[model samples]
Target: MNEKNTLLPRQLGDTHIRLLRIYKVVIESGGFAASEIELNISRPAISAAISELESLLKMKLCHRGRSGFAITDQGEKVYQSTLQLLGNLENFRSEMNAINTDLVGELNIGITDNLVTNEQQRLTRSLSTLKLRAPEVVINIRMISPNAIEAAVLDGQLHFGVVPELRSLSGLTYSSLYQERSQLYCSEEHPLFDKNNEAISDSTLCEYDAVIPNYPQPIKIKHQQKKLKSTATSTDREGLAFLILTGRFLGFLPVHFAQQWVAQNRLCSIDSHNRYFDTHFFTITRKGARENLILEAYLEELEKTL
Candidate 1:
C-alpha cells in the first residue's frame, strides 16, 4: 500500500491548500488555457500544479487532451469538498476580523450583468460608500448569473449577491433593490426589425426562433399567450445579445442595455409597451451565518443608496 494513500485529510498542509486553489481556478475557468490569465501563471506551471495535486491525492482528477478539458468524477468530488473547505476558511477569517472594531478583510459580491447601464442601479454609489467607511476592507465583485449568485451566497463563497428574483431558495434572505424592465428585441437583420409593432402579431413573431435565458426554470414573459420556439439559450446578457445580433433569433433584454444597440440600428424592441416584463432585483445573503460587522455596514450603505 502507498503511504500517501493512507494520509488523512487533516494532514493536508500549505502546499495542498495552494494546489487546491489552483485546481479550483482551472475548473472554474473551464480549461487550463483559459485559466492562464485568471491564475496569472503560465500553462506549464498550472499543469505542473495540477499534476502535483493528483499525485498528492493518488488519483486522477481531470482529463486534458485533444478531446478537451473535463473533470473526472473524483475531480468533481474534490472540487465540491474544496468549496466547503474554503468557505469554512473564509468564515474563520470573517470571525477573526470581527474581533476588531475596524473593518478589514475581503468582501465578495456577485451580481448579474447589464446593471451598469441602468440609471436606477445604485451599486456604484453603495460601493463608494463602502470604500469611504471601510477603507481597510477589500471588495471583489463578480459578474455571474442569478443562479450562480444564489449558490455562491449559500456556500459562503460570496458575502452578498445582487440578482433578480427568479425563485426563492430556503437558506437565503433577500432584500429588494429595484425593478428592471426587459423588452423583446430583434437585430436589424431579423425579419421583424423594420416591421411596425402592430403589424407583427403573436403568430408572426412566433414564426422566428426565440433566444431565451438558460435559467433552470422557464422565464415568464408578459402578454405571451403562445409559446415561441426556443432555438437558443444563454446564461449571460452578453451571450444573449450576441445571439440576437446574429439576426437569427429573438430575445428579451434590458431596455437600458439595448439602447446603444438600438441607436446604432443593430437591434430594436418589438413592442416595449405590451411585450415587456418587470423583474425585481434583490440583494441576497446566507441565513444562519454569523453576522459580520463589515457586511452589516455595507448592507446598510447599500440600503441607503436604494
Candidate 2:
C-alpha cells in the first residue's frame, strides 16, 4: 500500500488542535525560532509540535535545516485547513455564548462605507443602546462593500449587515433602516460652481465629466444613475465623493456626507431638488441561523429607535 493509505482515520483531540495551532504559527512566522516570542514556547517545543502534527497527518509537513525553513506542499494545504477550522470553531463559540438571556457574546456587524455620517443615526444609536444593555457583549464592525456584507452575513461570518436596499438575497431577511438622499455636486473650481437650478439644464449638467457608483442598484436608482453617463465609476460612496471633490468631475454624494464640504463652500449642488435620488438602506441578517441573543437585543433596540 502507498504511505497515504497506511494512516488510520482519527478524531482530533485538544492536543491535536494545539499542535496544529503551533504549526500554524511556525508557518506564519517563517521559522521555528522566529515563532518563540509569539508562541511563548522554546524552539525545541515548536519543533516537537510540528513533528507530532506531521505524524498525526502521516505526511512530511515541512523541512528545517541550515538551508532554512520551508513548508512542503502538504503543509501549505494543512495550514489553510487549520485557518478555516479555527474560524468555524470561534464562530460556534461566540454563537453559543450569545444564546443565553444575559446577551453576553460577540456581535459582528458589517456595514457599507459612508454610513457613519448619516443624519438618521439609526444604526449608531442601536449599537450604543445594545452596548448599554449588554455590557459584556463584544461588538465588532467591518466596513466593506454591500455585496461583501451580504455574503458575509449569509455565511454566518457576520451576525448582521447594513447595506443599501438593492436586490435582496436569498437566505437573508431585511429590515428597513433609513433613506440617504444623494445629489449631484461640483467643487468650487468647476465651471458650474456658482450656477443654480435656473442656470443649469439637464443637458448642460450631462455635458461635464462625471463619476457614478459602480455597485448594483435598484431600477429607480439605475434610471437616475444612467442620466449622468459617467466616464468614471467607484465601488464605494467614499470614492465617489473623492471624485466629486476633484473639480474635474461631477458626481453624486450623500447630502449629509457632503455637508462638511458644502458648509465650507468647497462644493455646491447642481439643481439638487431636480437631480437628487433617495437610496433606502436596510439591515440584513441570515435566516435560519443559530439564535443569537446579542443580535436579538440590538434588533429590538433598533426597532424601538426606528
Candidate 3:
C-alpha cells in the first residue's frame, strides 16, 4: 500500500487540510455567499474549493438549489472530523509559537461600567503600550456586570475581566488591585451635618427618605451588610446627588469620587474621624489561561499602573 494511504486518519496532507477548513467555513456560514463575507474570499473561490473537495473524496458533500444550501450525510461526518483535525493543528501551532514569541491573538475583556469610568485612563495607557509593542494583536473592551463578566469568561466569550471581589466561582483566578474606602455622605446643609455618631444611628438615619444610585452606586460592602432603610433608588448619580442636595435623603459615596463634594462642603462625610466601609478591587482571568503570553503581559502591564 502507498505510505500516504497506509498512514491512518491522523495523518493528512496540505490539500486535505485546506479542504477541511473550507468545508467547515461553508457549513458554518450556510452557503457560499455568507462564507465569502466571513472568509473575505470571492464566491467563485468558495464554490471552486467545495467542488475540488467533493471530487477528491468521490462524494457529494452538499445539497444546493435555488433555495439555499444544506450538508449531505457524508458531509456531516467530514465536518465533525475536520473540526477535530483543525483544532489539533491550531493547538500545535500555539505550542510551537509559545517557545519563540509573545502571545499574539485577540483578547476580549469584560468590565463593570464603574471600573470603566474609574480606571479608563489607566487601562487606555496599558492598551496603548500593548498596541505599540505588539502591533499585530487586537483587544476588545466591553462593559458588563461582575456576574456577567464571570459568565462570559467561563463561556469563552471573554478572555478576562475586571470586577469587584464578589462570591467565588470555580476555574477563575483573581488579583487584587487596591482597596477602596466609602463613607455615608449628605449635603452640608442636611440635618445630621456635624452630628455625633449616636445622632446618626440606624433609627435616626432611617427617618428621612434615603436616595442611593442603583448602578455604579459607589460600592460599599459594609453598608450592604448593615442594610439601612431606603425610600427610593436611582440609577443615575445625578439623581442621587440631586436628592442629597435637596436634603431629601442621606447617601453613601466613595471617599475618592466624593472628594470634590467634600472639599466644597457640598457634601459632608458622616464621620470624618472614623473609617467606615471598603471593598477590594480585583482583576480576574480563567485559571488555566494565564500561560498565554498576551494575557500574562497584559496582566503585567496592568499591575505596573494599578
> All candidates' TM-scores?
0.76, 0.72, 0.57
Residues 180-204 of candidate 2: C-alpha lDDT, one tens digit per residue: 9998888998998956464466687
lDDT of 1 by residue, 47-121 (tens): 999998898788899999999999999999999999889888778977977896698888899988889999886
lDDT (10s digit) by residue, model 3, range 1-306: 776454335567887787777788788768888667445689888898999888777788998879779999999998888767765554454454366476577767886654433433467777777777777767888775566677556544566787767667887888776666667777877887765253345666667667655544244454552455677776544566667777667776666666667778788877544525676777787766434566667777776675
291 Cα displacement, candidate 1 (Å): 2.8
Model 3 whole-model lDDT (C-alpha atoms): 0.68
lDDT of 1: 0.82
Candidate 2: segments with Cα more than 4 A from true spot: 1-91, 98-100
The number of clashing residue pairs in each candidate reads 0, 0, 0
Ranking by lDDT: 2, 1, 3
* lDDT of all predictions: 0.82, 0.83, 0.68
Candidate 2 local lDDT, residue 76: 94
